[model samples]
Target chain A: MAEIHLDGVAHSYLPNPTDERDWALKPMDHVWRDGDAYALLGPSGCGKTTLLNVISGLISPSHGRVRFNGHDVTTTRTEHRNIAQVFQFPVIYDTMTVYDNLAFPLRNRGIDEATVKVRVHEVAEMLDLVVHLGKRAIGLPADAKQKISLGRGLVRSDVAAILFDEPLTVIDPHLKWQLRRKLKEIHERYRLTLIYVTHDQNEALTFADRVVVMYEGAVLQVGTPQELFETPSHRFVGYFIGSPGMNFLPCRLTASGAEVAGQAIPLGGTVLAQAAGASVLEIGVRPESIRLADGGAGLTVQVRDVEDLGARKIVTCRLGDHELKVKVSAGQAVPAERATIQFNPHLTWLYADGRLVR
Target chain B: MDKWQNNRAWFMVLPVFVVVAISAIIPLMTVVNYSVQDIFGPGQSVFVGTEWFKEVLTDRRLHEALWRQFLFSGLVLLIEIPLGVMIGLAMPKKGWTASLTLVLLALPLLIPWNVIGTIWIIFTRPDIGLFGATINTLGIRFDHTASPLDAWVTVMLMEVWHWTPLVALLAYAGLRAIPEAYFQAARIDGASAWAVFRYIQLPKMRGVLTIAVLLRFMDSFLIYAEPFVLTGGGPGNSTTFLSIHLVKIAVGQFDLGPAAAFSIIYFLIVLLFSWLFYQALLRVGTGEKR
Candidate 1:
């Protein structure tokens, strides 16, 4: 297996991109370590698919180079790059049997029939498709067809990496978890470098050891699930990661402390120094990090709506003109009209502009 | 819970039935009537049971015409299908070139059959026409009116020229209907150019190819106008196809009984071949095991 690296890569469908909006992928450098599971997480039109295509050699980057194991392969064709990609929709050869579908790549490489048969069976077993080996691929259900598509990539052991572009989008909901777990098992067993692209946070967080969060056409953060949930590097990451997302309140950094809505709040010296740049300032805290407190203490909030979510409740409150959400456990009492809430000092973060302050 | 049986639905379909009867059934019945009768005049006719059918089937001229019809249609299909698919594949996929190509290809199909015949008649004249004069100027004795081989070749060329575009246009439409993802998948699978065509494009174009085959078969089998105008069944009846022979018997000799019998047999042959072609193509296209 080889580590895939994008060195200052950018792409534009237009011949001459004059503005930032014209570029599909802004210039960025990324390295996917060998044999590690990584997920490129972004919403639609954020260039995640563009980045995947560049890595797979399906499309060449307009600006920079793609290197595999330190060798530039930006202009190499997809087949020569030794990469396997599973598309968003299941793509199976309709005229072939399930066995033949899995054997196609190996046969195209002129692999011997004996070895192809062995590998095909092995992959079919791994994908739980042994029962369908003799069945026509066209007649199979969507999930089974997707399994055959995945098996095609997995059947070849010589591939550098197997990339999945939202492969489970067409699968039934109940089967998604099973298929995902199967993929994880296969990745661990084979030690194959797997890069999955998806917009669903749950899928990205659970599937990848490190999730690369992207916004617009740029990478915002590359961190583990815990790190992304606890310490988001950019405002978008913080807002996009959690269920209720992190709340931001307008604030000003002073020589002595930080002030929010004319009330002085405690701030660490490192955070205060990091926020020293003269620009927009805000304090970000997760909904779960804020606790309801007694009245006339800390920051007072007017309770707007409370949604009971079994074990915990999401308390949406108004502090001045800013809206904040506080997550309280079932044991905590919520006031009808107003409630005082205090942010956990260690969990709270400061932002100068949109980037997180150390 | 009894359902209402609407007897009025039969009345709703009566108009269509009447139109079909007036346009198709009445003419067909008249042919059948003539096939079984010997008409002396407007009111004097003899009931001849299967006599004209036996006579028409035994006619040596009918045998020659039938064989020629099959050979012509077979030649047309063999030459046109592959040539048309190649042209379709060579056409541009997008932009101005695609539009221009489509417009040019559709020009021949829009011309009337007799007009195509008339056009070829002038174009293939050995004395003055461009094609015939050029071949003769090159020192080759090419006269479609005098030589049987030249007559056959000219008729085949004219037929191919007039009808290959229909196949090309159909094949082009089939080629365009395939999704881009299939090509991408084939590339990732490391398929060669031939493999892509064999496994992907050919199978995808099966539906349109069936249409092209059936249409070319039926149209070529019944071809009359172009060959009739170009050679006029000259060179001693070398190009007297089934339809041309039928017209000659019906109109030229006024042998209505035998001509009507020949018409029924011709219709049956086309119907049988079309059904067989449809079944064979459907089986191949779907790759059905049974």
Candidate 2:
């Protein structure tokens, strides 16, 4: 296993990328520590897969160096890079048995027959594919085929990293959890550096030790799941990580405090100072951090709609032209028309130009 | 379920039945009638009750012709399939070169059968043709009209030249239909070039290869215009195939009864071989399940 580092890496599919729109991945520097499980999460076409391909050595970056354990490998081909990648679609050798499919990478490297057999059987057992060892891979269902693909990646012992590009996309919903748990177990047992690329937030939050959020071909924030949820460095991360996302309201920063729609909202002195000189000012708060105030002492909101979600209900309200969502527990009474909502002092965050202010 | 149903559906199928009867069944019945009868004239014929079939089956010339036909078709399939697949694999995958190569390979397939035979005949003439003259100048006395070996080689060459492109085009289409992910996965698996072709390319090409085999088999088995025009069953019947011999009997010598009997046997042989080929092709896929 090796730590992978991208130094000022950028990629573009175009022969000549003169404009920002031509680049598939913008210039960025990131490092994946050895034996770490990291998820590169983003929406579609956000360069998550492009970053994965660059890491796998499938595509060389147009403008930077890729180093593995401090060794420059930017020009290295995929085969010599000793990395295993599982694609979105299940790719299996149709003519081979499941056993042979798992044994292929090892056999390709001239591993001895006995060792190849042992490794294949070991990986097959780990992937719960022991019963299917003798069956042709083409006859299996999508999930089983995907398991075989994963087993192929795990069969090789000398791989530097195992990269997954949406490997669980074709799996059934119930089976996805089981497969994800199995992946975690394998990661712990093998201690292999794993980088999973996906557009799913839950998969990233649950599977990764650190999640890298990307937007519009650029890295937005890289942090642990709890850290990203609690204090997102960028507004996109705040909006993307949580259900119903974080709400942003236009505001102005004054010497006293931050004011939204001419109503003063409580903020720390330092946060207000950080936002003082910003051309764009806004306040972000998660829906769960906002509660209906019992007394009329907070910002007044006109309740537009309420969606009951069993344990908690989402209250969508309007304060002038700005829309806000507040999460209220099932036991709380929701006002029919108007209510005053208060933001938790510690949970509320201030943003100046979409960047978190302190 | 109701005991009685509308009979109007039968009318919907009448047109298809009429088309089939006129196109296939009627012609087949005529062949059967001719096979069982001793026809002296169009209207004056006597029922011979398998006499002609027994005579045709026992004929030594028919046996020789059948053997020659099998040898020619076997050689054609053996040479064409691998050669076609290799050419397809070597072809460029994209851009202007790929289109140019495809157009060039498809040229032979567009030529008419009789025209291909005529072109090869002039192109292989010993005195004037480039190929025959070149070989002759290289100290090889090549004369397809006189030497049986030369005639066989010429016919095989002509067959390969005219039809190998068809198999190549089909194989190319199959190769193109395979997704890019398979190749990427193979590369990541560290598979060698030969291993990639053996495990991925060949298995994926099975469907189109089956079609190529069946088409080449049927077309080569029924080959008439090309060889007939080039050789005319020449060199003392050394290159006479089944269809050529059958034609000589039915039309050249006007022995309609024996020729008709032989035609049925020929048809049955082709049908049996084609069925066997199809079964073998299908088994390659599903047999591993057991």
Candidate 3:
């Protein structure tokens, strides 16, 4: 419903932040477009929640200007900003009935009772809470309480966006997807601008149109899930986004290509051209990119272990003190001990000082 | 999962049973023994067969004292609960200032009850006391010794001053237990200050508030030392509550038969009221229409 622009935003809880470690959220700029779903993805203590709070106007950033639709709103309070945030722990008015709980936001904003009733029913219906509309909010299951928290945000018509700070943390595993799908459905029906902050990669990839991966209080990369997989902008993103994350092997540059364990691994001219001046260089490749080459056309490595994961087998090998994993279909031919493996040139990337070379 | 069916766990509870029998049951049984008999001497006594209970129950002065006790407790609760909650809400949430203020608030509650009364006795003297002299200086008639109204006011003031801090401390603990997210959520909902207090704060404080109410009621209902030391049950029995009246029969008159019966009845009355109060509070909490 509204566009949010963060210009040079930085925050530190300390009175004087003299270094990077002192800052809870380091400097950054972003424009969150209107009516788009976005996810802030990071592990705990990575400042994703702090970033969400800054956007919601819960905390005044130490340095920056926040704009809403090109108008300054840096000092606006949360109530005035028209932001609705669902916290990790569900906060419900336990003494009130579910109807009253959902009606609270509208009533607080002085919306008439007639409109409040209609909107409350609409939200309850969308949330599968129609049967519990008349019951008290207390003594319900945690998942139900979480739904009530979400419903509280949905009942307000003037809300510009709904911010979720890991709202599904308390939900049951089976109900997590159901709630996520309900959120997607709500976003589709209303086109509400939503920013969901979660440490879970699966949740972030499943829920958002764009995922912003954060590490150590800084945004590493902002891209779709596919982009994060195929071409991660940062090595941290490469490591964080995938299951059994990307493998890195320290490589030294040569006239032709990079040499890994004294073996020449070919690269595109642009990649080697960019890596020519880097002091620190490494090659990162995913397990799926490594294949068992036929007739010993590649490096012969000692196979250490094979992990069977249903349809595929991951062959972990050691090539001159560097460990590598080659993912293969269960039906593929694999040597019992020594196997020849080759990296897919299109999928493998070169990193200089933990950043992509090209 | 394996369920342990051992009966040896019962022996682990024997120490608690012994401690309860020695500390509570023995003394209570002695009171019950005295309540049913008329003692002529240390070893010679006769079974009174509930005569003393009837006398103690029917005494007009005792009836007045019971009514006075009820009135005092009712007024104390009506004043202390809200005032304590207000103080709790007004206190700083954190930092060194909050710790300092908590220490200052607890100073009144740490004084011994008899010492509180002794301090007030001098502090409320018509001529020598600062409080009483200040009131007289303001052109007000002041004397806790001569007028029943003055004595009642002085005792009520002392009681409130000494016990209100306990309630405030409990309420403060309750308020502090609420998570910060609730306040953030309330702010985002555009809730007014009063609405936040009504819907979020008050509901969260209900459990501690119930404990505060029960403690204040029982403590005020059985109050004795402060009023006795400050007013000496004086000004024609204006502040002589049930405890003071019972003490007067037991110690001042040494009428053991009726005093023992009075003590038993007083205990039962408190137990009954506390049970009734707890039930009412719990009902008010859980009687939601669902």
Candidate 4:
């Protein structure tokens, strides 16, 4: 395991990244500690995969440096970087037996035949692929093939890191959960520096020690899953991280409180200080943070629609003209249409120009 | 999607099947009929059961021609397959160079086969041709007209130059079908260049290589016009492949009965070899263990 550091790394497919729009990955600085499992999480085409590729050394940044173990690896070959990567689809040799496919890297590096067999068997067992080790890979189911792809990455213990690019995307839903759990167990047991890239927040949150939320070519926030859920540094992160996602309602900030659709909701002293405007100031709230207020000061809203997701019910409500969602627990009854729902302002995050005001 | 009852579907496939049956089935029936009969005139004939087949099998002249054809086809495959694959791998992955390379490779394929033979025949003459004059000036005794070895060499060289591009184009298409992620995965695995080619590129190219091999094999086996023009069956019978031998009997000697029987046998051999190639490819391709 090795610590990875990125210092203002920027890249573009075009020669010149003259503007923010030109860069595939915008200039940013971050670090992932040794043996830490980090997930680069974002929507598709949001540069999360690009950042992962950069870390794997398949791509070089147009500016700045990437350091692994305090040594610059910005321009290094992926082979020289000593990392194993599992792609979105399995890259297994279909003609080779499962055992041979797993044993490929070891054999290529000239490991002895007996040792190769032992190692391949061990990885197959860990991945629960031992029973079919003698079978050919081409006829395997997609999920089994994905397991082979994962096992291939995990089999090599000498590598500095293992990168997975949406490795579970091709897997079945139930199998995706099983594989995520297995990856967590593997990371704990071996403590390898594992970097997983995914667009699904649930997968990222469940598998990684720390989640790096990204959007529009920039790393929005890097923190524990709880920290990201509670306090997102960027508005996009707030909107992207949750299932119904965080609600953003346009508002104006004044001395005493913030005005949402000409309604004054008194804010605490701390909340007011964080509500200073730069441009397009808005108030943000996660669904779980807001509730159907009893009689205290709150904004009036009309219920739009309600979604039943088994355990929790998601109520899409309109606060003035803006559509917002609020989550109600399984035990709670959903309010009727045109219900005047109010929310707790203490949990609201004030945003200015897409970033946290303070 | 849509229901299969649409009449347009049959319209799309009818033309192809009609074209194939007309061009292939009719000629094949004629060959089969000719193989089983002895024709004395246009309308007079007598059925001879397997007589021509027995004769062809026993004829030393047919054996020599068959052997020559086999050697030529093997040589052509050996030279073209690897050379084509290497040139394909060397091509640039993207941009104007890729298009330029494709157009350049396609130029030889556009030339008619007889035209290629004519061009090479003139180009390799001992006196009038540029290649012949240049070699003569270099003091090499390269006389193709009377030298069997020289004639064979010239025929082989002409075929290679004329058909290597087809193999190269097919190989390039195969290489292009591979996704970029596979290479990225290899790179991350720390695989050497040769390792990547052996394990990844070569296995992926098997399908295309099969087609290329079979096409080249059939083309080389049936080769007549080029060698006939360039070498005229050579100083001796060194360049006399089976097709040339059949042509000589049918057209030169005007022995229609024997020639027709020989043509039938020749066509059967090509069909048999192509079927064998197909079976071998299917086993390798779809039978890979999972």
User: For each prediction, how big is the interface RMSD?
Assistant: 1.4, 1.3, 1.2, 1.8
Off by over 4 Å in 3: A293-295, B1-7
Q: Which lDDT value does model 3 have at B85? A: 96
In candidate 3, what are the lDDT values of residues B42-104, reduced to their tens digit? 899999889999998899999999999999999999999998999999999889999998999
- Pairs that clash in candidate 3: none
Q: What is the DockQ score, from 0 to 1, of model 4? A: 0.55
Q: What pairs collide in candidate 2? A: none
Candidate numbers sorted by TM-score from highest down: 3, 2, 4, 1
> What overall lDDT goes with each candidate model?
0.90, 0.91, 0.90, 0.85
Tens-digit lDDT track for model 4 on B1-290?
Answer: 46666766988899998998899988877877887888888789999988877887888999999998999999999999999999989988889999999999899899988888899888888898888778988998777888888888888889888999999999999999998987887777667899889878988999999999999999899998888887878788988889889988888987766777888778889999998887787677455433
State in Å the error of residue A6, model 1.
Answer: 0.8
| Residue-level lDDT tens digits of model 2 in B184-232 | 8998999999999999999999999999999999999999999888988
- What is the C-alpha lDDT profile of model 1 across B70-178, one tens digit per residue? 9999999999999999999999999999999999999999998889988988888888989989989999998888889999989988998999999999999999998
Number of colliding residue pairs in model 3: 0
Docking class of 2: medium
Residue B232 lDDT in candidate 3: 79
| Candidate 3 chain B, run of 10 with poorest lDDT | B1-10
Looking at model 1, residue A321 earns an lDDT score of 88
Give model 1's docking category: medium
- TM-scores (chain A) of the candidates: 0.97, 0.97, 0.97, 0.92
Q: In model 4, how large is the Cα lDDT of residue B161?
A: 88
Error of 2 at B47 (Å): 1.6
Q: DockQ for each candidate? A: 0.52, 0.71, 0.75, 0.55
Taking the tens digit of each residue's C-alpha lDDT, what string does model 1 give over A95-161? 7889988999899899999999999989998999999999878888888988887888888888889
